[model samples]
Target chain A: MILVNENTRVVVQGITGREGGFHAERCMAYGTQIVAGVTPGRGGTLWQDKVPVFDTMEQAVRETGANCSLIFVPAPFATDAILEAVDAGIGVIACITEGIPVQESVKVYSYLKDKRVHLIGPNCPGLISPGARCKVGIMPGDIHRPGTIGVVSRSGTLTYEAVAQLTEAGLGQSTCVGIGGDPVTGTDFVDILKLFNKDPDTEGVVLIGEIGGAKEQEAARYIKRSFKKPVVALVVGATAPPGKRMGHAGAIITGVSGRAEEKIRALREAGATIVPSPGEIGVTMKRALRR
Target chain B: MKIHEHQAKAIFARYGIPVPEGGVASTPQEAREIAQRLGGRVVVKAQVHAGGRGRAGGIKVVDSPEAAQQAAVALLGKHLVTHQTGPEGVPVSKVLVEQVVPVERELYLAIVVDGSGKAPVIIGSEAGGMDIEEVAAIHPEKILQVRVDPIIGFQPYMGRDLAYAMHLPSAVVRNAATIIGNLHRVFIDEDATLAEINPLVLTPDGKLLALDGKLNLDDDAFFRHPTHQQLQDPEQEDPLEVEAGKYDISYVKLDGDVGCMVNGAGLAMATLDVINAAHAQPANFLDIGGGGDEAKVAQAFRLVVADPKVKRVFINVFGGILRCDVAARGIVQAYGELKTPMPIVVRMRGTNAEEGRQILNDSGIPVRLVADLKEAIAQLQQVGRR
Candidate 1:
């Protein structure tokens, strides 16, 4: 159990908003421990007529002993929300908000360098551990199952696509994490891979990457040097054009480093089995695990 | 969002950076007047977002106002093709007329947010007036960078180190550092992702001036900078893309026939790759986003079919927050409104996928719903061959 498990008590930030309220209920329905809700003005109320709502993170943390934070705040105020959770001494934070400015993300990322806390995303689908029954994101909970393969990606629905295929192939996952598509994120492929490397239950890992930055290359270097498990890699955006942002803010080919071909080459050279297309992620991972 | 050189210079000037005396002119007469005001020795540069303007004959040096008018006439209201722009090129509606400087050396300076480093980095090089990518590839040692800690902010010593590394003259090194500091300030204050001064010229008089400027503002930070959002020039963008933007859709027009509409950015790109792998081309890249409602999906469908080159359509949705039923209903609604009969292939999975499949199957519309992505591609290819 990495990042989140059954014992992890969760706090829903911006719980009064439409996205926050909806996802909070779904996460609860998935059997996640919804400890408390935080909405500044809407304190002293009950969310879904069960969980308590607090005006501040400090109050929520003290009252509910919530160890993890799931943020669905809008982009403009999301930075402050993440900082609030950080200040409240939350052990784990997952921000599902999208479109946060890079400046704000960089600042938060810099601040978290020395902290022991783990921040998941500002523009991500979050993570889920089916075995632990701990869902802390907006991902569809049914597609995931408890198994040996650990999955991490830089996308949302794409992760779901890979997970659905894995489940159909009877390859369940230990944990599925989306580090986000933003240029700056709290956790990355290397961070999640480190956790998977140490977990005894995680037999193999599936790393999904795209056309942004050199994080994928860095991950490849890590896998080549230290990772103990067989790795399966998929780098998308082979047909994307240069200088054009492909949907994700970070999914643009700025220079030679951000090209998909370069990332795929690095991963392949690192001795990881590369999935040729998105549809092949499942069978590729299963084949790598069998070896 | 990329702003023209003139707009970038204006923004840089506000931050106390020294830019050459220049004015943007939309007409030949206006260019003549601006050139005359600048002592009649000016450089008429086409104001387009694409680069390689000098090699593309988009830039010309003229010594007289009459010649400046002629240069503007040759550039403005014409498509200036460059290596950055496609072969068709972009329309140049304006020209920047600036006083020509006597340059002794050209340097490059820029502040870009390093995605891997997770901070802003100051990049400086002695090699300038050419593509930085080429310089980076050929002489990687020439590119010197200093990472600025976002928590500590941009420090003077960081800029000083970059300027010193560029090996500037002692007389102008401090001034160059100051300009770098100012550029960093502009980058932070304007929410700009990229702020660059290519060919930061050093004149015989020991003065440093920004000969060219380029700034790319962060579209995600538009809520904070409403004025910067107004700087968007729709004429420089594809009309279909501009239309997609109004409905909060992410779209980019490409040269292909299979129109692709997907729910996520990563999935959308993979769809394009899948189409190409099937020996077909993707007309455009469109992402309806994570939380696509019925209306938004309808808008995305309309935009996809709007491209006349679209021979077939591929709708791939792995529904998470956006239920498959919603996407199917939206597609069915769009197909009715569009009333354009074309081969449509949909591959939907995850939440409420069965209901979505039923919605499309009962919509009285002919849609090829494939359970597997590979089968979907094969079916799409079969239709393309027909």
Candidate 2:
């Protein structure tokens, strides 16, 4: 069941920082084969949880055969950190930092050509494959159980909401990935959906999304084009006036075209049984199962 | 951050953009003195956060200095209701005392984000001093839009064309072009999302002057301009919503009894709508944002519970990217701290959902695990006596 298993060791970039240290400790606790932690000048030392530290991604990957890199570097340094991970031959790169400059994420994404690597997020919460026990983002460790529902979202908190609901509905997850909040994200929704589609264990899907980006529309198109399982969607920003910025800062979807109505219309048109409230996710999934 | 017209003018003047002489005062005596100093009939305008001050009697033409003082006295500390400032009304914090200009021709000019394009766009009209929304909806023909090229910057030809559209006198056209050019520079340089000049006027004497100015800077851009921080007018804003922004939670208080909690803004709003669709009212819309640690989630629960208006509770989150288990831990942690004595319906789904449910089930918290979004609403509906 492990497509990329324990041998694909992880190197934690910015291992000295708050998010990095916290998640690094959690991932190690979850039994991820963590090879090394990367924090410049913190090399030759050990993380509080006793993971060996290295000065750079190159050194860590070179020395320990760490092919998967999880970056918790702050915004300004995130660009360089992801690139270093990619350049260091990391097969999978998860940048778990929010507020990464959009332009920087784009440049890094654009530069990823010819490299057979998967980039998850520059603003995402990272991914978790249950029972494997490795967590590379801020998602808590207590709620996961190895089950069949595959989860993907443009939101971090909403992802938790859907997961909780699915578990209560007696559905478990194969993998949960936070695609992040940035407008220009590293992975498209379809990319993760495809992964779930291929996983035999993932029977159904719960996709939590918000208004603004064309990402949901693209997901809708992908669903209509290929996906067969009953997909439940929770699209946020209803009654939220389009084009006015909020706490996500400048994220606003305005006018007749980008409003919640249009996105919901597309989602519904694509055969997604839309769950109006995140609170109803469990109930809705139960209903979906019965159908 | 929003500053008054006079303050905006002061800021604009520093950037070498020509503005008509104006002074702000909180007292009647100060208004009279400013009017006398200007040596002309004055415009007494209430300093509030809304438009339509001219039609609402908030703005008055005072022929004499004494009349200016009387008008200032009447306007000071008074609440001026306008369409933009909402029902609570914008409080008259001060009075703008300015020389009355004789207008031969008027033009409207503004720079705001094109909500459709997600770009800063310049809007200009031959008709000045009008409600922009009305102008946009009605006489859109008069409104000339110029897209500021992010790369090459605002072209000189765009300014010249916009100036020509205003049909200013030859001497004033050059001045108008300079103002438009400077406005573009100011907009990009300041990281402003909206910079408007209402009644950008041509006086009968053939001088071009900016009668009023308004600028709304990008909140994210405020980090770069520390000195330009302005106080939010609470009377013109939502207190709970404003307070929530400080805690990094996007919260909007609603008239519903079911207090709803979710992790994404879009999801939160959808939750509210679903609550409504089920004929249940949502008490509040709360998003815990992307940083979903136990503390942040705990705080989100705390905020939901804080609302006395809320009767039953609906907790929903989709941990598609967030681990379902982490969310469960956060829920258990918060439920432990408060004992959350209220009847709670929780629907958490996505990755690690099964494990997350096990964590919650083990927590011994008296929380209902709803089957989905609608059933949770239906359950909340049954419990709501309100």
Candidate 3:
């Protein structure tokens, strides 16, 4: 399991809110170890009549021995929630909350540099390990099946599209991670690719990227150097105009490096089979693995 | 969330950064009054969000107040087309009139978020007063960058290093460093993604003045800076896009015939790409977000069909937090409300997808449901052919 497994004790931040409660129930139904819930001033309460609720992360950690944090806090307080989780010694954090300011995200990124923690996203769908039955995000659990293909993407529904296609192609995913669509995210493609490369269960990897930033190029370089697995890549936003942010904050073509063609060329040169469109993600990955 | 040049200059001046004396004018009379007060050679610049105003005849320099009025009259309420703005261009409602400083040299300075680094980087160059992208492409080595750690923040020594790297004169190195520090402070304090001073000029008196200023605030950080949010001009944006924002939907208008409404940003862009691949242009990019209820989805649908160029609508939703049933109901409701004969195609999956498809199938609406992306593209192509 790259980020989560059956033994991972999860704490639900902002569990009392509507979105948090709803997703927590879904994750629990998927057989995840949702050990505790945290909402300020909601201590000693029972969430869904089973999970324990605490006012702070520290108390939740002390009582439940939670190792992972799934945050659904609002944008304004989401940064503080991540820091709280970090301080409480949570090993892994997946923030589902979107629209966190870049300044706050950068500060969190700086603070987490020395800490022994894995932060997934401030604006992402989160990650899931189908084989381990460990779902840690807002992704629909039923669509994922247990297998060896590892998928990492900078999108939410687009990751779902790829995962569903993979499952349909008889290539069940070991884990699917959405690093997020924000300009500054906690974890990136390279970090997740490294985990996927080392995991024994993950046979191959599929990287989904969009416009904006040189992150795909960085991942392409890493794949060429050390990754010893079949890789298939798909970069969207080929038709997107420059400078106009297409829904995602990070999906804008600012300069020459942020264009989709540049990223596609870099990935193609690095020996990864490039899928021409979103429709081809599954068959392309299967083909790359066979070769 | 880009602020006008005058607004950026105001913010810069508040931080004790030196900028040429300027005033914003919306009318020719106001321009004349401001120019008379400056009492010297002044430049009238269109206060649009785009760059390249100087090359597009949006900027005019005059020695007299009458000439300033004439320049304002020529620019005000007229569309100023530049390379940044498309053929239609943006209307110049206001102009900034400033006293022109005698320049000894021009330098570039800006603080922007380095996306990959996840930190703010201070970019400086000796070559300025032109497009920075051009300079970066032609002379890549001329661009100097210093990444500022958000934890320790921008240090004075880093500013000193940047000043020395720019090869500034000894007399103004300390002053340049101070301005850089102040600019960094402004970037952090204002929650700005970009705080730039292109053409930081050196006057004959050895004083550094920000000749042109541009500041882009982080839209996500607007909750903290409510005052900054008030600076947004709705007139400058597409009316439909502004309407979509009111319903918490992200919408960008495009010159395409097929309208796309998807749940996520990446999926929406991919939808556009696929539509284009099918030889059908997407009229707009619209995302109703993760948890779109019936009402929000209806609003999003209305926003998409509101575009006259949109002949058909395509809804591709891989529902997670947003249930397929809810989206289907919303689309059906919107179709009924609009009472238009526009064709609609949907590819719904994930949570409650079967129920959602059933709802759409029985809605008495003539909607085509496709099983996969390829099928959906084929349907879109057929619709375009009609």
> Each candidate's lDDT (Cα)?
0.92, 0.74, 0.92
Task: Using lDDT as the measure, name the better of candidate 1 and candidate 2.
Answer: 1
User: lDDT tens digits, residues B1-386, model 1?
Assistant: 99999999999899999999989999999999999999999999999999999999999999999999999999999998999887889999999999999999999999999988999999999998878999999989999999998978888888788888888888888899899999999999999899999989999999999999999999999999989888899988889999999998999999999999999998998888888889888999999987789999989999999999998999998888788999999999999976568999999898889999999999988799999779987998889988
Q: Report iRMS values in order.
A: 0.8, 4.9, 0.9
Question: Which parts of model 1 are misplaced by more than 4 Å?
Answer: none
Q: What class would a CAPRI assessor give candidate 3's docking?
A: high
- lDDT score, residue B192, model 3? 96
Error of 2 at B145 (Å): 6.0
For candidate 2, lDDT tens digit of each residue in A1-291? 223344658899988887677778777787777789999888988788567899988889878888888888877678899888888889888887766544345457667745888888766767777756666666765567777777788766557666766777677777788877665666767878887778777788888777665677888999999998888887777655544453343245633445667777888999989885656787787788679
Instruction: Put the candidates in DockQ order, highest first.
Output: 3, 1, 2
Candidate 2 residue A50 C-alpha distance from true site, Å: 6.2
Q: Per-residue lDDT tens digits of candidate 2, residues B1-386?
A: 56677767877787778787878888999999999998859998887766678777898888888999999989988888775455556788788998888888778988865422334567899878877667777887888988764445677778888888767667767778788888887777776656888878888888878888887665544545677666445555556666666777777666668888887665676677777777877888787776567667777777777778777888877764455688788777777766436777888766666788888788887777876776776777766643
Complex DockQ per candidate: 0.84, 0.22, 0.86
Tens-digit lDDT track of model 3 for A44-128: 9999899999999999999999999999999999999999999999999999999999999999989997899989987999999
Mark the 10 consecutive residues where model 3 chain B has the least summed lDDT. Answer: B335-344
| Stretches of model 3 off by over 4 angstroms after superposition | none
